[model samples]
Target: MNFIAKQMDILHHKADWFTHIVKLSPRFLLALLIIPVLGGLIAVILPAFGWAPALNQYTIGLEGFRALWQTPGLSTMMLLSVATGLVSTLLAFVMTLLILAAFFNTAWLDYIQRILSPILVIPHAAAAIAIGFIIAPSGMLSRLISPWLSGWELSPAGIFPHDPWGISIILGLTLKELPFLLLMALGILAQPEFGKKLREQHKVALNLGYYPMTAFFKVILPNLYPLLRLPILAVLAYASASVEMPLILGPNTPPTLAVAIMHWFNDVDLTLRIKASAGALLQLILTGCILVLWLAGETAIKYSFRDKLTNGKRAYNSAFWQKTTYILTILVISFILLALIGLIMWSVAGFWRFPSVIPEQFVLSHFQSASVQMVNPLFNTLTIGIISTIFSILLTLLCLESEQLNSKPISNFTSLIIYLPLLVPSIAFLFGLVWLQQLANNSSAYISVVFSHVLFVLPYVFLSLAASYRRLDRRFSHVAASLGAKPFKVFLQIKLPQLFAPILIATALGLAISFGQYLPTLLVGGGRIATITTEAVTLANGASRRTSAVYAIIQMALPLIGFILAWLLPKLFYKSAHR
Candidate 1:
């Protein structure tokens, strides 16, 4: 009887400890996300005013801002950044809405999702390189039509990718962002309760003599747009301050403000660091301004279209819009497919000249040579991705589990916190983070890089898993508890197994986001550690297209492998469990 009583006490202690830990998870998560960003911003703000003790400039003067203002082509850079960001975000958002309107509540949505999933996994740098290859002067598109249709023996001298107006940058950003927004929209629409309500509303509109497309626009979009606003703002922020795609596809003479800031930060002159800090702050302001402008535009449109919305029009040429949406969808998909094919072709071709639709001879030398060079970068990529993703998954699970145990939904402020990393420009805070690291005399670049990745990765993992975690039935846990299972034991043995698929999917997403990180790895790693993304971006700027293709392929393959495993492991686990 004493032994039995002692065992019961031990179990009670364990349960108490588990409950305490779960209750504290939310606070821990909020701190983990908020502290770094706040610290980085403070560091940058100090340096921008010339108060950097590391550089022995103790005077808090406006020297950095003075130099930044005097910089040549500053206006052009700012204009380009704002224009490209606004245009690309608008295009991607519109395209996403069109696709959603055309395919909502239909079987085509699933097919579209499956087709675009791979593109979603492809890293931004890799996508830029692939698109650059397809659109360059001596690219596959020019080659396919040369000497026959265009009647040009030599490669065309067109300013395709590096055009002075930053058109290619806009195109590349649109392509990369469209898939993300579309997938996010699809995920929201796939939810059972909200989706059913929207479907029923849409049906009611249709029965009231409204055209399908018009009905979707009037009935579904108003409800959907509010949910999608945050993601759109995040996309706008990223597009405004993007470094990777712009560096590869944008003009060099007067690059976008973000690219120019990166150059200043990397310049050999130490004083440029101050200017870079100033530029970073300016970037933050610029992003804020653009977001404000977008909001104002939204308000304007809402008032302007208030009459049309309630005018009781059903079929105002909905067919034409539907056809246009269909055509745009095909074009976007085809471009992505062709860009991928171009990357594969470039990775294998040997001495292939222009105007050849197919390579004259395929060689393994590029892959062979690149494999030897890729060893370190590939290892670093896997190490960082795996460690960061694991931390993200664990933290996400804890936060979600805490929510479940507490029976509380996430607050709006917490939702904003989850998106803070994405909504803020990376260049703005990352430089400040590096300063903090240096000030603290922290030299562990590997650990720093992994932690930086977690800041970005945790949000995505949490967003991906939160819905699935909350939707989980509670009866299983109740039954397990009734059978004398502890809370932790029920979570491990029952909840985890049931939530395996979503956890794996979230893990894959975390890995993909980590793999695609170029600026974070570059800034936090302090140029000491290299990843596949960094190597690919470096090679994309060089003369060797084959080498660039090789690195891009390897970079893309890592995320693809993660997604494949995520898809397969769940099926295998379920099959074995059944057997």
Candidate 2:
């Protein structure tokens, strides 16, 4: 009886609290929007299980499952997907460590950031295309060095670009994912006391006679791992299920599973859509399994190293290895620079053929031609990207502030939503959206495309804003309230001023994300729209390499512009404020 009375009192307290809040602020209205979000999830989940009566499938069974299981090359494709994802992730982790160890306190960091941001903003599809153009036997690399150095023609048998073993795909993804990981790690390592902590950890390991890199691996990396886990998982999800990069860089005989799913979805045979949906569900399952493997590996590494650190031993100690690592780091950075240069060369090349170190002819013609015909799509991309980024930034700031006010956990839910599109096969949710689109009969507009971009853009905005939000001083808000400012007024007056730098950064990052979207644009815009990214992907599907490179350059341009805005906005604003 006492327990029942306690529960009743708790209920009464909750009801009173809810009534108070519901009457207090208009911001509470945002909670009502979640209903549509949940409804969308339910609509997809039902059809995903073969329960859609609209498709004349009233009954549920494992037939779709059986079909997905028996798809040709399914197992090999799954393995390849997993391998590519894992290898790219592992390489990115190691590369980030190497760069940090080598350049953490050095002047090299600024130069590295300058060179990398442009490369990072280059779309995945564009990277794949650039790499494909360079590494193919008949590609530019062979044309430049092959017969002169090796005394052989650039032959068709020189299968380096889309090699059967999927190494090229892994390499392409690694190159693309590395810059992002490095950028994310920059924000993390820039936090207060991180440098002091890393330096302290280094001293301790050095006193124990461990090499600096080894010290990082043994101590600093473990601490960094948990901080980095979400971005790593997000990358793994992308490498596994990416459609564009794999399509350009993967094996021709049997493409990556993501590509295969796309083919199944687009196949003229209507029933194949069922198989595609099943494959999407399987992709989700595979993503979950790989995440488990990743976590298990993380645990194993932790346990394996915990005792070594507890004792006075360095398991990774090697001065010679450290020297070699330094050399390798230089080489990798050089190669990435080379890749960026190659992209620039291709963007400007007019009639450069293979075996020429320089373009036989250079012209401004490509850019001019691309610009003239490309204006409409470019306008669409910028408008959508800018609008969506603005919306995402506004919503993210409000949500973060709301979460802060309510003392609720914010990171996990926002991170999950942001990374969801990256990790799961895009074809799955996109396919589910087809029915929603059919119902609305209004999927092919700039509005729908921008909405899809928002889904991708929100998480990045949230992720970028999170650290600033968490580390923010709460005293300012309290003081503002004490001064008789309302919560909204306090946010505008107190929070916004302090967060201007981060807000601008997040908005620019969000714009870059929206500008780079390919599948969502394609899926939602229904070919009635043409962003540079979508146009690049489509042009690459044909035999016109020249025209494709033109689009690729345009695709790279918008993000470069966004990154410049991100980089310069704070400096300009801060200088003006100080003045």
Candidate 3:
């Protein structure tokens, strides 16, 4: 008995030491998050400056940039990238704000929240395809009211999708992005300070004769925008450099700058890698320029609205804004719901021709075929999502436990480091990470891909888990300790059990983030591992609407299943935990 006690004590001490290291040392987290991002940027830059020996470009020169600059329609591509990024971001932000201003705190808000999760879980490529399915020439909308509405036959003559002005791309991005921005905004409003102060401000403004819409805009948005700035910028960066959306929805003739950069990288000849690196550098510069312009626009809006805000004038357009906001929200939500319906109808559809609302025949052949063919991608999708989510939960648990044990908030520096992956354009650094991995000869597809997913997933998981983890009263742990429970046992038996609900939510979010990833999986997996996203995007470009719909449904369904489990598990197993 004495010997067993001694051994147990030794193990406890070792565990304590390990926990202490994780808590006290910032270096590990920095290495995982910040160093890689910075290092990847440097790697790309060095090659961009013509210093890569792997490609035999040993001379320090601007030839890479020169070659990239000489690409056809370079100017048009840049303009498309900038326009789509800004327009989509602006549209999403405005729509989100309008919805909040019009319907927040009402039953409408509850309905939106209830449906928001599923909307957000729809992968970008799936969303793009859904939107394209309705708006394209041969799509459901045209088929439903075609000759009666426009007197056209044979599916028209133009690309509603892949339009030259990038309007369709912008619309596609806006539809997908609005839900995300709204979700984030909801999270922000849930903050104690934001909630309390916003109510107070709204009341104060209302008492001063301002209407509800104006009150929210004038009183709440100013205080709220700063908190949301990072998320907005992240979205902008993503929009500017997005490959999947552009490939599916953006103009194909010139393509967005990000797609153009990818073409250079994916060229058959390896020498084009030098120019690709230069194009990647150009992408970073382009993102930077867009961000700068966004900031300037922010300043301009603030200045322009200063008089209207300060004068306390009840704007006459408040009612008009409110009416339009509700209309827009209904349209946006209805469009998404209808799009999902379109996907479902198409999945089992058979031989549906132009000007027909319903298919001439319905069959299960699509699912029967997809079931066999999609097994690999579906399995890969599930495996990668679970793996990345597990890693995210573990890393976040470590960080949160460390914060609890140390009784200190994570430093602002660490927060910025975690957000680095979100804000920095993936095109700028992902290729370099791929290059580094190649140089190191690490070729495990699953490991490389999941690592990339984890990088993106960690921030979201941490954000979701941190509040619950911190809000957990320390009294329970103190009592457990007083009862002679070792730190390890307490953390295992007490803390984790107490956090079952939040942990589930975080896991679900991480899973969705990983499941939705397109570029990371493609780049990190070396194109050998096909997830549903890759398959769906690939099928979208071809004349396989039925087959693509099958993939899209699976892609959208996987994350939703995870989320349902996340929401249901806590209720079923830990009923009392909700209170």
Give the best candidate by lDDT. 1
TM-scores of all predicted structures: 0.97, 0.87, 0.94
Better of 2 and 3 by lDDT: 3
Predicted candidate 2 versus true structure: per-residue lDDT over 153-232, tens digit per residue: 53546777767788988888988998899888876777779857876877887788776666766767767777888888
Each prediction's total of clashing residue pairs, residues at least 3 apart in sequence or on different chains, is 0, 2, 0
Q: If candidate 1 were superposed on the true structure by all CA atoms, what would the RMSD be?
A: 3.2
lDDT of 2 at 29: 23
Which residue pairs overlap in candidate 1's backbone? none
lDDT of 3 at 441: 77
Ten contiguous residues minimizing lDDT sum, candidate 1: 1-10
What is the C-alpha lDDT profile of model 1 across 55-75, one tens digit per residue? 878999999999999998999
Q: Give candidate 3 misplaced runs (Cα > 4 Å).
A: 1-15, 24-26, 575-579
